[model samples]
Target: MLTEAQAWQALDAVEDPEIPVVSVTELGIVREVVAEGDALRVVVTPTYSGCPATELIAESIVDALKAAGAGAVTVETRLSPAWSTDWIADDARAKLRAYGIVPPQSAAPGGGQVVRFMSRTLPCPRCGSTRTTRLSEFGSTACKALYRCEDCREPFEYFKPI
Candidate 1:
């Protein structure tokens, strides 16, 4: 009979399948977790709706909860509120940079307090220089955009904040 907090603590230990360096919680993926009757319901916000990672993430969330002794865990994806880069949280952003990916830079709200991930200039992950250019809006993954480091002369991807 684990409490809701206890269940979350367990789920928090589950790391992201793609970014193993950070857990889904740290990544702010788990938006809500609550116990209903004899079942546990978890809400996860997708980084990108079309991104294939959403499927795997949902599976991992369910498996992790069950492994943590959750009697019946129901992982649900909520798109109504949608996911935003702003929800990445400060801790997750740091973990991303340490994981060799250039995290999105926080900027003033573009229009309606919406953190603009793409409008802001992304620095090169290799050289840490702002003098970077976008080679393409699309990257190796649909969630990322291809970029070139002008200073390092290397190509890296910026995890666009969705």
Candidate 2:
């Protein structure tokens, strides 16, 4: 029988469908992992309740554990406390940057980030230019925002603060 640690290790291999740079574990989606008897139960929370990845993420979790040798896997989603960026592992943050998506700065009390400055400056992930401006708060994805890099003249998206 595999231990809880082994189960987590198996989960670490499951990458986020939207952002493959980090695993669902690093994204703070998978909250709890418990092995009871021959069955393994996992608790997951979506970044946003309406996020499309919710269902896919849960399926990935179950598939991952089962592939790891668990007799049975149960993926549970918990929305009570909600998911926060604070749960993101530091290593995952670095991976986000390396993959060109700037990880959120910090987790605000509510669902948004604590805006300390006037203008939010996100460097262009493509051209490394700070001349990026927010085009819109919404992007193709629910969790990102549209941005345009003036220097590179390329349109990109900011992962937004969570």
Candidate 3:
């Protein structure tokens, strides 16, 4: 029988499809894990409800647990109390920076507000310069914004706070 600790350890190896540098657990996606009898249930809250990788993430979670000797695995999607960038682990934030993606600067605004327009200056992950310009509201994904660093002349994505 797989214990909750083992399940969590197995899931810690599951990386985010979009951000491969960090595990799903590090991204704060895997909310809870329960082992009951011969079955295991994993609770996940996606970065956003409309995330394109939601289905894939769920599949990965189930596959991981099953591969870890879980007889039956079920993935539950939890949307209420929606996922927030603030839930991101500090180590994950550093990983994002090292991966050249600008992490969210502060806690996401309350009241279910998503920050689409960045009013504050975002430091460049590569050059560590504050002189940066947002190239577009949408980056490689809907959850990020494209930005260019004036100092390094390199373009990068900023994970939007939600």
Pick by TM-score: which candidate is best? 3
Q: TM-score for each prediction?
A: 0.84, 0.89, 0.93
Give all candidates' CA lDDT scores: 0.76, 0.81, 0.88
Worst 10 residues of 2 by lDDT: 109-118
Which parts of model 2 are misplaced by more than 4 Å?
A: 109-118
Report lDDT (Cα) of residue 60, candidate 2.
85
| Tens-digit per-residue lDDT, 1-162, candidate 1 | 457898789877888777788788877779989899778999888877677778888888888778777788889888767666777768877888877677766532354554345455777766678887788778877666778877888888777655
**Candidate 3 ranges with C-alpha deviation above 4 Å:** 112-117
Q: Residue 105 deviation, candidate 2, in Å?
A: 2.4
Better of 1 and 2 by TM-score: 2
Model 3: which residue pairs collide?
none
lDDT of 3 by residue, 89-149 (tens): 9999999999999888878877856555656799999878999999887888767889999
Model 1, CA-based lDDT: 0.76
List, residue by residue over 1-162, the lDDT tens digit for candidate 2.
567899999999999998888999888888889989878889888898789988888888888888888888888878868666778889987888787666676554574455554366778788788888777778878887777889989887666766
